[model samples]
Target chain A: MTAKTTDRDRDWAAALAAANAGDARAYARFLHAVMPVLRGVIRARGRSFGPDQQEDILQEVLLAIHAKRHTWDPAAPVAPWLYAIARYKVVDAFRRRGAAVHLPIEDFAEGLAAPEADPTAARDSAALIGQLDPRSAEIVRAVSLAGESTAEVGARMEMSEGAVRVALHRAIQRMARFAKGERG
Target chain B: MRTEDLIAELAASGPAAPALTPRGTGLRMLAAVALAAGLFLMLAGTRADLAARLAEPLILTKTLLPAMLAAIALPLGLRMMRPGARIGRAALWFALPASLAVLLWAATFARTAPAVRFADVTAFALSECVGLIIAIAALPMVFALRLMRAGAATRPRLAGALTGLGIAGLAATGYSLFCTQDNPLFYLTWYGAAIAAVSAAAAALGARWLAF
Candidate 1:
């Protein structure tokens, strides 16, 4: 290989190694290094979602690159592994935020309701809810348990009813997220 | 390969996310099932008539205590699951409403004079304050999952919601056992299901503004 090409390759190798070693500074370089590819995949996915969402997708990927660094197999090529994650994250973001997408939320809803009827769904359902805010946790109860109107509930709780509605809506969506044991 | 072909080749060659250790998955699933089991205890307990039951055990004041516990512990449990990110913390701060807002809403809705009762309002506000802090601490977990990169099934939104549900669900179940005992169906039909449903809804909405 030419001297420039060899040096560039060595630089990437060192960057990847430092990232794997838990070096935050090096990881930032790693994130910067991967940005072009990340943006490319995002842009390739299309600009249908507003620029903000598209940017969000990229940000999500960068954060993922940071958080899941340990999961990378040192033996594997980094580019494609990252590319897939970026792609999946963007698609998920689109589905999640009601962003511009080729498919609509209805399609997602249909799939989501595929029925988490494993009988054990309830048991599997609880811990996930623990991850949200307590008031949100309360809102989940108010709307679901008390059957209070969202507006009344929100007002009583001192929040916008619409915000309450949205919070409950997302919580349900999250709970209904019973996987078909596919992620194994 | 051409750029597109090269990219496609790269994509095709990517490996699956590293498997969470069997122990880790077991821990996660165990936590889920354990929570579910704990919740069932509480859930079944709430099936009694809370009013009549209240007569038996000072139920009115203490029955809802489990619910309160669920509110606090639930968020703490959720926060433990987060991967730690700046935006995640920010999201937690934004999630809790000001205590004044709750007072205003209560005044507007209740027939009681808005100006009169000091103790009850103070108590409620204090609990609200406590609840909000607990939530703030735990709230970050939900967003942290989001801020961290996702893998196979650990969608940040899903993770956050489930953690919240698991923590809150069991506690709510326990609360129902205590408070709604006389009216088990009351809590089940209302509170238990309501929180779960609403939490899921919030997670869904979260997919919007909380993106990336």
Candidate 2:
């Protein structure tokens, strides 16, 4: 690997290790840092997808990374672990749409420097939230869409911050399940 | 929702528990084997001459073949649990024990007189052997699938098949102790059939359960 790639992997690995140790800021930083790489890879692979469809796939990748984070070994390099999930989600999106595509592993390395952009519009994931219980839907929307902190949402909902976090985690997990075509 | 918003939500969800290590997977697999052993002993004790028979090369081969298969498949199945991890050369390793068994079967079949070859193959309790092997495998297959589900398997069907193959190998090992049928012609056909059935079932189930 290149020196730059080594540095990026080291940073991501450390951040993810800290994130797993309960540092939310580190986790956020890790997610932000990886977003451009993930976006670039997704865009390159799913060129036929509209902007919204691409975002939907990106959101699915993000949710999968969250839900399956426990599958990543701390001692291993973060890039492969991260990109594996990205590739799986991208391939899954293609399969769901009745298309078959073969993505070369090297494609991910080239897309690492691609620019990140906001989704043109909310789509599948936005609709998935409505399937959550009313309280969970509110908690997810308040925290994600309105940019409210867990503490703020907890206070407004008369729940503990810890409870809010648990609820949000469960809600996100359910959304992941829903996205994968699982029923309640 | 915007990508940034999704990132915020995931970040706030807090850290996940540590990934399940290879050692953890090994321990769970051992526990499943223990459970299968318990079931095997309860339902069908070892053959009367098992202690003496174990010293015989043919008797030992029956047990060792599946045992070896399980040993190799455990790591391969664990690799399948990871999203992008390639099983690489470990997958090719399966051919070692597999070819050994097939060659042994072919040699044994050829040496037997053609007239009696059919009798030798059908001499055992075919239904009982197949049923017992599957029965021994059933619970362990569930445990293996559960463990597979806990990880992010990108190739769910393949992961499931590997797990099933491993579990069936263990189950077959246990069944070998109870099975007195020493003929390679008999054990090879029925045992192979049972393992294939289990693998296929797991592959179908994994496609549905391990998708995430």
Candidate 3:
């Protein structure tokens, strides 16, 4: 949209158009020209990521550009299309990392003191489990509430680890419904 | 893994790639359309009324209209093969002939009573005519898509649809040779539907195969 963007698009479009016509050197030049632009775009978009993650995103955008090179329309502005691909790669990286909730340790330092476990909370968890099928309830208690590994729960229940995990997931869902005062 | 290495690899791989051009691709599409027409004529001879209909402006318009559509669409399809390229609003020009055909059909309908119009529109060979045109378009559709894949079609679905429209229009033009029905209403309804069908099918195929 800006004059700067228009210039970049025009440059890229011309370079890529030449590249598609079997000009290897032009293709290299196009790639070289795009690399820094893509890196900057990725860095700005994924500011939450570290240097390594940003590099990974940059590489992803590069690979995507390579794989989808033939999909670019030579007559259109190249920068917007290239940046759109970069944005998608960044989003994919974010999705792959899931979500991280960060807090400064300085603010939580006073709260780090050990506190007594609440019996009512434990009792409430138990009551929630009591609403599930007996087998599922036990799996949830072991794998979730009791902090037992899935392998340990599986071994104790004589079920495959995957089966135990599945049962536990269902039990947790039912427990969530119960907590929300909804019938599961 | 490094950007320089990636660029070097891409550059190195370039020699094996053929030098492609929009003009060359456009010519190939024309060849495909011609081939489809040749095959259709060889397989299904011209209609019994063809010699007589050749002199009629209205009958000649049926084939000419589609030929015009194909001519317009060919360049548009070629344009779509490149990344960043778009089939401009100029493509709307194709609709002109189609609109005229519809108008001509309306005029015919008014002149000819409802019963005669119904008889012409519901001709027994209607489905077969549509099917034959679609069948003729199939091979050209493949050729067009292959040509398109060789280029960078950023909007694959649109590119494919345009290819289909262009190729199918040509195929319909060829089918017009064997079709005895001279009524614009029949051509508008059946030919229009057949072109739409081919375009839709091409769009679907392009979405799956053409997208990177």
Candidate 4:
């Protein structure tokens, strides 16, 4: 099924149809009209592709459209079909390079998952735990903020592993309630 | 090359494209088939006992099955010559007549004694028939390839192979007229091989020559 055509798309279709009918000027105009938009399509895939790669893909799309111009259905809108070829060429270039540029999961994790020692978060945690008694605050900070194992916190606090885990769970539940209360 | 230069070069040509007439292509293909048939008749001649063989259904099927394959494949090959047009699942219909021919071959083998089956498949015409069909196919294949070049084929190799199949079918039909073998097995094996050989050769050539 075809999408609704815009005035811009109709202009392209008319030019291409005219070009098919032996109008050289119209064919040149059609090529000129599409080049910028085709460049934009390739550019919009982001900077993972270098300038040379983008140019290569753009030339490929233009060549394909030119070579296969007769195959385009004159009744259909031109823009989508042309962009589809550009997209395919871009993808082909990416595949040919063996690997695509991608931001790794760790990059996003660093951006979104605030580190334990983030100053603002650490201050907030300190304020929240300040409400606790000295022993509870020490246990919460060692096990949660400081990223210590339960057994290590247990040994440091002179308690069993099970006891340390219970205390850590209660500390998290209390911190959650306190935060929700502060938000409310 | 720069897009501007490419555009200028393409537009500089007298016409954007030739008047692609599918009917004209179909006629040329038929003419090529006829020419190949005439050549085959001149070289190998038609089978003797022509009236008696025509009376037999199996013999008639052996002679005409390859023609049926051509009838089916020719239209598809012409359609595929157009860029962006696909053979699609509809091309699978080519196998229907082919499968029927294979079934006939199976029945022939089942009904005949093993010793006779061996003799029938190994007849003097067995190998010669393949050679004759390929010989007859050469002209039609060239015609089909030239016709293919007139259209912009996206998948040149596939289009070339399809044209080869159609042309080979026509060639096999011509060869069948001269092929005297009564056993379906011989026609099925040798004819199928000749068509495949042509298709493979055309596909290889198309890869090098058919792209727009």
Candidate 5:
């Protein structure tokens, strides 16, 4: 693009080289640089899922990206790699509390197998459900899991957006409670 | 605000990009040719001044070439061979220059050292091989910062790191031909350590160059 853009590109290339070679400080710089993208993915997806816990998903995604970066080949463009990371984080959000298709036991099990199964995830999910009032869980399932947009879910549930928003908010709270295995 | 401005703002608010990737068998062949030329220069120079004459091409390749090449080329070549591992778009625009700066660092090492000898044309390359590796590793951190500021996005940190290491390894071979003196340990340890430090700094900085 502009000369400044070109210069930036060149420098980015160098940072990657350093980080790949195993520089902690360089990796930190790398992390700082990309925080915006992480935030974007979280915010964009959070609008639908409710922003209450978007930051949590973003953190998970970052950890995953950091932990699993060695598999990437150098010759390829990094966008797809990042997209893949974001996609997983978004899916994780859906699974945790957002509107998501409650997969059959077998299907969910299979999904769990692909990313090292965390016995604690299921435990956490159950715990979050415990804290939520019954009404909240139903709203969460319908809005976050049942593939219904907030408006659509609201209309189907015969409630105003305000009501839907309130219910969803409570449901997300329960989900967060489950995730942390804490009522607080 | 206008929709365009909102979109721009949103886009700017997103994670940075990290562009990374490589070439073909013919290109590999070209590298091989370059390696050969570099080797010739290095070996010729190493032998140019031995009273006892440790400068033998076959020996050089056996002891220094393979280790140096493995240390450098295997990583770089594999990256060339496997392009799918990186998430290239995540790097910031400024990062590109930052990497250039790192790569450029290798060239500076080529300047005449304390002992510029006739054989240095060849033997000196040993040092260069190590230097190049240092440059490759160091480039990404600086590159990423520059790219992030310029607004490039990146992800897949491991990919960037591997590629950086691989590139450093390859460049090191060429560099080793020029920089390596009679001491193998010196190149492996001292030079290697220096390179590692610089590379670590580069990557740490480059991480920012990529989008999250």
Candidate 6:
């Protein structure tokens, strides 16, 4: 079990390192790999939450991880950092809903072995995206939901690919901020 | 949105800018200190005896104490910026300088004649001393908060308080050069009050601004 955990950590760390070095495909793989762990952890700790609420927390955690990616240290194991962020967001969600719970670090280890569950569409994130300006919202929808490339989205929108990418990035950041209750 | 779709979008967002290193944090802090020092010098010129006063223990303590606190707080604040980072014994390290300040104050309080002790505590520009420290710290506090915002501080209030403590230390250190009050009682009261005020303000601000 220890060896398996070590191997998982090594792979996740390597993928995240690659992602930091600008490998998009590796980044996608890393995110996909961590999703189950995050979902399990959230579900375990947030038992009071309904499935939709759990997923909302999951999505918020994912957005936070993306926005704060620079806080991760490549030299350190990814698990602690990943679990810390997940725990923080989970605790935050609970706090916002006016409840308190304890989540020991041991729970994260158990979360690793949790059964994989399909993700449902989350409402909060969708609402945040809807709150974004029209152009940014359209670009985000095209790129993520439609799975279109930046180049494709840009061509359709009559903007440069770089412009599309920047818009999308800013939109994601704005959504994260909105999730945290920031205005403008 | 589906988690899978969200992951696809995040992955497509491209690589983040490089993670900030301890060295980078140090450099930015240094820049903020240098700017604050420049402002301090311009507004309140250094005392003429500044060179000679360095040899005096009390005069030196005034500067060294805050400098020590700043040194401790800079790294502590930085560590708090990372997610899941345990503060451990680092939090305890603050006691060293704090104890030193209290010791110095006690020693001076004991030696001074009772008739002069009260006068000593209130002898100088009490409001100005605190006002100057806060003013000096204003820019650095903003800079520190910006740096904290760039990182992911889970304990935003504590992190903000640390930043305030660190910036106040640096500001007080710079202020000591221009401040002519040498009484340990006066410096300790006003300087301590000023640092506390800055830290409290930072704590309040951090609770709001440092979220996420």
By lDDT, who's the top model here?
A: 6
RMSD of each: 22.9, 10.3, 10.2, 19.2, 16.9, 10.7
- Of 1 and 4, the candidate ahead on lDDT is 4
Compute the lDDT of residue B199 as modeled in candidate 6.
87
The alpha-carbon deviation from the true structure for residue B212 of candidate 5, after best TM-score superposition, in angstroms, is: 3.7
lDDT of 4 by residue, A35-136 (tens): 988888878873665564466568777777776676566766676567655665566556643221121222324535776534454454556677666777
Off by over 4 Å in 4: A6-11, A40-49, A67-184, B1-14
Q: In model 4, what is the error at residue A76, expressed in angstroms?
A: 6.8
Residue A71 lDDT in candidate 5? 35
Q: Candidate order by DockQ, highest to lowest?
A: 6, 2, 3, 4, 5, 1
For the predicted complex of model 2, DockQ is 0.54
Put down candidate 4 lDDT per residue, B1-212, tens digits, no spaces: 45577668766665566546666888898898789888779877788877787789887887678788888777877776655566779878977896897688888889988888868665567668888889889878887788777766666788788778888888887777777876777678788899999988888877667764
lDDT for each residue of candidate 3 in B142-181, tens digit (9 for 90 to 100): 8889877776566778889888999999999999998887
lDDT of 3 by residue, A61-150 (tens): 777677666656555677766765666566766664323111112112323442234344445555777888899877866644455766
DockQ of each: 0.02, 0.54, 0.23, 0.18, 0.02, 0.57
Off by over 4 Å in 6: A98-184, B121-124
Task: List the lowest-lDDT window of 10 residues for candidate 3 chain B.
Answer: B11-20
Cα-based TM-score, every candidate: 0.31, 0.77, 0.66, 0.68, 0.32, 0.77
Which sections of candidate 1 miss by over 4 Å?
A: A1-17, A20-44, A47-81, A88-184, B1-156, B180-184, B201-205, B208-210
lDDT of 1 at A19: 57
For model 6, residues A108-148, the per-residue Cα lDDT tens digits are: 23444552431212444467678999999898677655557
What is the per-residue lDDT of model 5 for residues A70-181, given as tens digits with 9 covering 90 to 100?
4344544445555666675566566655342232223345546754565654444445555667767667656544545656666777878568866776666655544554
- The DockQ-derived docking category for candidate 3 is incorrect
Tens-place lDDT digits, model 2, residues A85-152: 99988888777632211111122223343323323113455567778899998987786556577778
Candidate 2 docking: what grade?
Answer: medium
Candidate 3: where are CA atoms >4 Å away? A1-30, A43-57, A64-184, B1-5, B11-16, B49-51, B121-123
Give the alpha carbon lDDT tens digit for every residue of B90-192 in model 5.
Answer: 3343254334434434443455364642334344464455445454334433332332232222332443343344334444444444443544334444444
Per-model fnat list: 0.00, 0.88, 0.37, 0.32, 0.00, 0.85
> Worst ten-residue run, lDDT, model 4 chain A?
A98-107
> lDDT value for candidate 2?
0.81
